[model samples]
Target: MTSIASTSQAPPLVLTVAGSDSGGGAGIQADLKTMLALGVHGMSVVAAVTAQNSLGVQGYWELPPEAVRAQLDSVLSDIGVHAIKTGMLASTVLVETVAEALAGCDAPVVVDPVGVSKHGDALLAPEAVDAVRSALLPVATVVTPNLFEVEQLTGVKVVDETGMREAAEAVLALGPRWALIKGGHLPGEPADLLSDGEREYRFTAPRHDNRHTHGTGCTLASAIASHLAMGDDVPAAAEKAKEYVTGAIAAGFPLGAGIGPVDHGWRQRA
Candidate 1:
């Protein structure tokens, strides 16, 4: 018999505390896919479950606070994590639960304040918005919010590229170390602003004509966390993540009856 050889090296580990998307376009599914594509080991703590598809989210149900806490403890206690990412925490209890668990964590955290689905379906509860602001945002190393989420969290409505700086400031005031304000919704080229109160970095990409960008938010946040786990600074991670997401968006292909997902494996294809 031939002897098998094995290596001792292991990839960085990234944990995603979020919801599960049945359609496999966003939430935990997208997070894990992004992690894998970026060469990280992906772990998950499902905070909610959604009946979602290309068209819209029909409904969602959050897990009990105790269950969510248990998952977090189980993952953090034994396997450990190099970084963490969060998305679509559906309720106030779950938001508070996850925040409490991550309060003293040493690893970097990426928070995607997901307010609505791609089809305009509500993902985060309106009442839970306060919990996300008071509890969740404070624990984030970096918070990535789209225009709608920026307004939902800070009442800062960003209508153009110029307003992104103000939006980043408003999110930073909520206690995150850095804020990444996504300006994809604005007309013209898609631009995103990253700031840490003092220095600022703007990332812009020519708008792809594709509309199948269902998992862009989750994918970008997860990619940032994966890069952070691999020892990149916040700004460098954001830059690389933006590049990866832009390629994925450009390679997006339609699925189901409506919007589709960005190709998580685009790098591999290229």
Candidate 2:
């Protein structure tokens, strides 16, 4: 009998399609860091580039649609991402390209409908909002949006905790099987409302009294993707991700003259 060689397998791959933050506070940097911290292999596709920092974004330029599509194919064809997370697709073409590519990929997708940076800079174009709704969101396994994003997508104002239901309902209507409306932007305790159209779950956390919460959204979405790659269910992944982001916020640090990014490595340091 001839002996055969054993092949070593690679870890599960998670891909993030987003912008580049020069400051490394949010966007691609935050996504990769969060994925790594959660013990998942992370990949990237640059959709846009921005001169950004703690203060704000100075300028931005989106990549050509063909380039974006090519990058997606290059990765999905070879490395085979286990989960996909998207953020800051600045134009309608890029959004459409991602949607078309991911529509057939069999994997959980965590969609962070990022409309703005942490410092209130406009990252998404008005024309692209429609694309995000019609193209990307429908294919999302879990759509994670904060108060502003909820309003942008659904035309609903999230004034308080009670409004999370309406926001989630509207988000589910956009075709995502699950919607996680982050309530951290709401007053009172830090909590999030998740709905699968049939069921709803509340993830509560003690609000950290820290201003260093720049990358919380990106971190949460990446964490959820990581857990999904590790085989956690939607509800479990969302809950665990919320807990992780809370801890990260609690341990957040100020890096520049303005609000800073959350500490993605808080758990390791502890």
Candidate 3:
């Protein structure tokens, strides 16, 4: 019998395609960190560059479409990602290219249709909204959008569980296989709903008084992608991700003058 030692390799590789966060709180930085913390190999393709921090996003510049496509081809042809999470792709051209590039790939995708930064600055461009809706969402395995993003994408406001149910349906109608509607902006306990156009799940956590709840959406999407790459199903991934983000929020740290980011290395430091 052959030992097969020549065929062995490490765990699955997870890729994060998004923007650069100079502050390292969210975007590619946070995604990579979350993947590392979860014991997975992390890779990144920066689609845009942002001078961002806990205070706010100061400025941004989208990468050329050809550059984005070249990066995607390079990664997909060689590294062969197990799962991919897309964050701030800033423009319609980049979004369309990313959607097309991942169209034939077999890996699952967690789409965090990020609109505004943790500090309330717009991340995606006006022309990109249509691209995200028509191109990207259809390709995503699981699309995670917060309340504002839900409204931005579907024109539905999630004020409560009932509203969330409606909002989830509206989001699912946009073409994703599954929709995870984050309800953190709603008053009261931290709540979110995950739906598959058939079954609906509610994830709720005790509202923490901590004002340091930045990078949460990015963290949750990355956690989900990591779990999926580790072989968890959509519901299972959602459960694990919810648990991870809950702990992250509970252990979130203050970094600047305004809202802080979720501590991706919380478990490591503890």
| Per-prediction TM-score to the true structure, in the order listed | 0.98, 0.96, 0.95
- For candidate 1, write residues 76-174 as lDDT tens digits: 999999999999899888999999999979999999999999899999889999999999999999999999999999999988899999999999999
Off by over 4 Å in 3: 1-8
Which regions of candidate 1 fall more than 4 Å away from where they truly are? 1-5
C-alpha lDDT values of all predictions = 0.95, 0.92, 0.90
**Candidate 1 lDDT (Cα, whole model)?**
0.95
- Model 1 root-mean-square deviation: 1.0
Name the runs in model 2 displaced over 4 angstroms: 1-8
Check candidate 2 and list the clashing pairs. none
Model 3, 1-270: lDDT tens per residue? 867556767887999999999988889988998999898999988899999778999999999989988988898998799899999999888999999998989999999999998777999987789999999999999999998999999888777767988888998998999999888888888788899999988888888788888788888999999999999999999989998888888898888787888888888877
What would the per-residue lDDT of candidate 2 be over residues 48-159, giving only the tens digit for each residue?
A: 9999888899999999989888899999998898899999899888899999999999999999999998888899999999999999999999999999999999899999
lDDT of 3 at 215: 81
Question: Best to worst by lDDT, what's the order?
Answer: 1, 2, 3
- Candidate 3 weakest ten by summed lDDT: 1-10
Residue-level error in angstroms, candidate 2, position 234: 0.4
lDDT of 2 at 28: 96
